[model samples]
Target: MMVMVLMIASYSVGSIKVEAAEELDLQAESAIIVDAKTGKVLYEKQSDLKLPPASMTKMMTEYLVLEAISEGKIDWDTTTQVGDYAYGISADPVFSGIGLIQDKDYTVRELYEGMAIISDNATTITLAELVAGSESEFVKMMNDKAEEMGLPEYKFVNSTGLSNEDLGENYPEGTEPNADNLLSARSAALLAYHLINDYPEVLDYSSTMMSELDDQPLQNLNWMLPWEDNNFVPFHFEGVDGLKTGWTQEAGYCFTGTAKQGDRRLITVVMKTDSKEERFNQTKKLMEYGFSQFETTELFEAGYQIQDESTLSVEKGKEEQVELETSEAMEAMVKTGEEDLYELTYEINENNLNENGALTAPVEAGQVVGEAVLQYKGDNDYGYIGGIGTEQRVDLVTTTGVEKSNWFMLTMGAIGNFFSNIFTTVSDAVKGLFS
Candidate 1:
């Protein structure tokens, strides 16, 4: 007789079943699925392997353009003049061009839409030039943003994914253009995650399966969109949205697909698949597995109580002890089906904490005073969570004529009392002798 054990995680919103011994069949050279909110890797297969990201590199380009618009350095409605450089870069056969006329003006918004929805190579280069003054400078900005996001595996050589040597027509002699862009599965997922969090408006274009620009119907390159006719890449999966797709003789096929199930959103990056259909199929399988197997659990609320233990001892104060607690509650999403529960350890800095340190002035309720580290010993490698420790200021006010007993006041009193007592004793002895 076979007995089946079912594990369920009950959350405030709903309950999710955590499947036991079930895993996703990720059929790609490299792949990763991450929680967009926490930057946690939910599932991974060769995630660190560096591979050509193909058109997914455009996500960063889109990010920089959107950032510039938000900064007021460029306006969506502002007209951008198409230059010889833009036209020259667009001529690459591998890239989708907007047929932008040289010296003709188009609003920054229109160019951005063309680059994002249509994946127009020319529009990307043109927008990069406008924002960074040149494609080279814009590439630098892309690399900078990647580093800022804590992604060290990414490198950008050009705004457009076209080969770097093809850029010589636009640049002068002795200038060698580098590879257009490169990223690992994890890094690409990070880029996509940043876009989703930073500029949700990007989905307005990425989610669009088809659009008409300049009398031409620009179809989305991402094949995850469900089509009425099942003839093309026939796999019906729900909740999938538009992202970028790429392929070359060297890069193979790559796709970054994002899907939403209720409030939970997952980003899946699959790199160097054998074919476009395989890439989408692999992504669909991974997404379905993620939704079916794991569920989110909110361990603690933002201001929930963390510790209610004995107060720490303080020196030279009216209050003998101070209450110790976290400004916020510790929360996490854990994989179900473990007999052994994970542990959250709180580490407070004894040095920064004053003797009998009651929260002092200028304290924010949720300010970090210490960190709560989480440790889990599951079949998967040990996992940890940090940054749950916090400090709040003590709202102590001095009463009239009553010396306020705080760290500052206590130190001053101790100094003054020692010197004043010594001087007074010396003067009294001298007065007695003179008398």
Candidate 2:
């Protein structure tokens, strides 16, 4: 049968399709957990609701900075003098600043470390200005990058996650002065997915639990991470690392956290939680569920062929049929013991067939003749993030070449069929007359 299929080439065996675990009933207003490698959403609660991101918005700023460095637009040692706008914000003890001096040239590396490790408001502004010449222009870049990355719901008003009102007349131009940066949980998880996949070096900064800035100690806002001398004790999970945290009277407590445990990395977001401690506690619930319930399972090996539909009929070829197999192995992160819920279906390329539904002779080995789609027979099949890619389906290819039949053999077969038909017709006529 002819069929259409969706492909998620960047994901493993398409999206994880298995029975939904007991609902987490996450406490946050919006929350989502995604597989970092495949961009699959393991769990979501009101994930599409747009809400103020608070300092979590800095993750985009961090992404833009790393992109600039990789593109040769800036270097770690490249320095820019702090402007009065940034210097003014640094002097405020309430906004989480490391105290920058006016017009002091600071390296990109230093500013980046401050912004990432501590969610320093002034350092974020400085880095944005350095990369885009002004915070207003940088805001434009942030919005542009969000669209480029296929983030479905997002709005960037400033490089820092702080509301524009807090900027005190320094907010980016062309934006409402009272507006706050907003993003949906799904989009935040997607941004984190792209950030780590595109610039993994970011973890080097976000993973730091403590850093020193000009003899002043700056602690990461993400308390789930381990400290220099020991784990954070009560909150620290074994693989807890990167990401960013945010808070404001308007945004409450928000966190975009990522962790890796034995080759499997997960990214979680919790927004509008009641308290700082609650955010981490909610994150721990999501992380524990993912690690304990799901596992990377190989559904099919490379060269796997369908049981009854292993070959396609060939017309005028030495061999009557051509064997087919999958192009590659199929793997997925499915609930343990629920792997059998997946079923494979394939559709042959009708364009490659003749009126008689047989392939033309001279079929080349490894030629893709059709597609094999993997379907999930389970509930709560949250699809892959970004909803783009070709990994969801496998290409069905020929296993060996099929040569055309020689003219002599073709002629002989036709002659034999003609006589056999004539003999059978006469015998049937005589039998009918006798009866």
Candidate 3:
């Protein structure tokens, strides 16, 4: 698995990660600590191994539901009848899980809290069915979204993190709990990355230690919250906030947790620990180590002049050469104790240039002429493989004889522009089909 530092102007996904530094041992079978602002992995222990994520799988479910609401496909007041499958799981009353009544309808808002806070299996299935019409179909959507998010390793057999038992008689006879909700610690962190960053409001639900369902108390499963009693949890972290926790006889104790210390937010995923407190303890250790041990370093200044000799050769313009410079700065987060810093190198992408490999004479100021790609190598100089390195247009200009192209060349340029626009439109429409 790879981790990388990203410059945050805002949050978005769809990029690959590269490996960075290594850290101390963790008790969990698979664990990862990620810098939320930059998606940098501060620590890891078998993070790429596939393991049963249990209820932590619900993170993806929560994200999808929230995203649907954000996109206006669903509303807070939208309601769905509690079906047989959802009602059966709710009625089980095992592990203090919420019981939903058949022949009754529940709003999306209610189910969101139920699934997020208490990790209610029935409410999870309820929202799943409401979103996709059936559990099987909902599971498909989960996998699809996983692939879309670059986590092809995740496979969802059910919405809730049920394992170590049959899904009961409510569904088909062959359904078993925790069938294939396998995920890597890295994948889980990515899910949390999108969860907290894309839907910052989710913390509102996950951070709650308790809530009410039909006037009955609903307890949050996360043991790390800074709340009274902590249900006898060994420690109470000051900034620890919202996230999901899961466990089963087969999956053991697992938690996908997050916390904010100062301006930095960190995400930790610990899977298959010996007990609940252990998972929380290890996660706490990871976060504490991250905040105490690392700090951000500016690798490059924004709009830094990488090249200003004004010697870039022009192929067909009136001018013989044009000036070039970088358009954006790059930042990197590194360990605090370390003295050496990440190295930055710049290069121009040939493919980013226009026809004739020259500035169309009289180019406007600030016009993009080529691509400037920046790369990084850590203090060890081993290279940051998945570093989310920076890329920007190399803006440049020319002042005279801009309209030098003959009628034939100009006609072809116009025709090429027309075809490019058509292709882009078609591509965007196709992408919208899946979104």
Number of the top lDDT candidate: 2
Which parts of model 3 have CA positions greater than 4 angstroms off? 1-23, 169-178, 230-234, 307-311, 315-319, 337-339, 354-357, 369-374, 379-435
Model 2, 287-376: lDDT tens per residue? 988888888777878887767677889988999999888899877777766676776666677888899877889889998888776666
lDDT of 1 by residue, 318-397 (tens): 54444434344444445554423444445554444554444343333234445444444456641211112212112111
Q: Alpha carbon lDDT of residue 22, candidate 1? A: 32
**Ranking, lDDT, top scorer first:** 2, 3, 1
Identify the runs in model 2 with alpha carbons over 4 angstroms from their true place.
Answer: 1-20, 228-231, 312-320, 347-362, 369-371, 388-391, 403-435
| C-alpha TM-scores of all predictions | 0.77, 0.84, 0.78
Q: What digit string (tens of lDDT, one per residue) describes model 3 on residues 1-435?
A: 111212212212233343334545678898887878767776777777899898998998898899889999898899888887677677765745676777777899888888888888888888988887887777778888887777635767777767525475444223454264788888898889888989999999998778887676778877778657846456567688869898877789999889887788888899999998898888888877777776665555555544333335553444556555445655555565342333333344455445654444544545554444334333343222123341322333222223355667668878998999999999999999999
Candidate 1 residue runs with Cα over 4 Å from true position: 1-23, 91-94, 166-168, 171-180, 301-310, 338-340, 349-351, 355-368, 382-435
TM-score of 2: 0.84
* lDDT to native, each model: 0.66, 0.85, 0.70
- Positional deviation of residue 256's Cα in model 1 after best superposition, in angstroms: 1.5
Please identify which of the two predictions, 2 or 3, would achieve the higher TM-score against the true structure: 2
Best by TM-score: 2
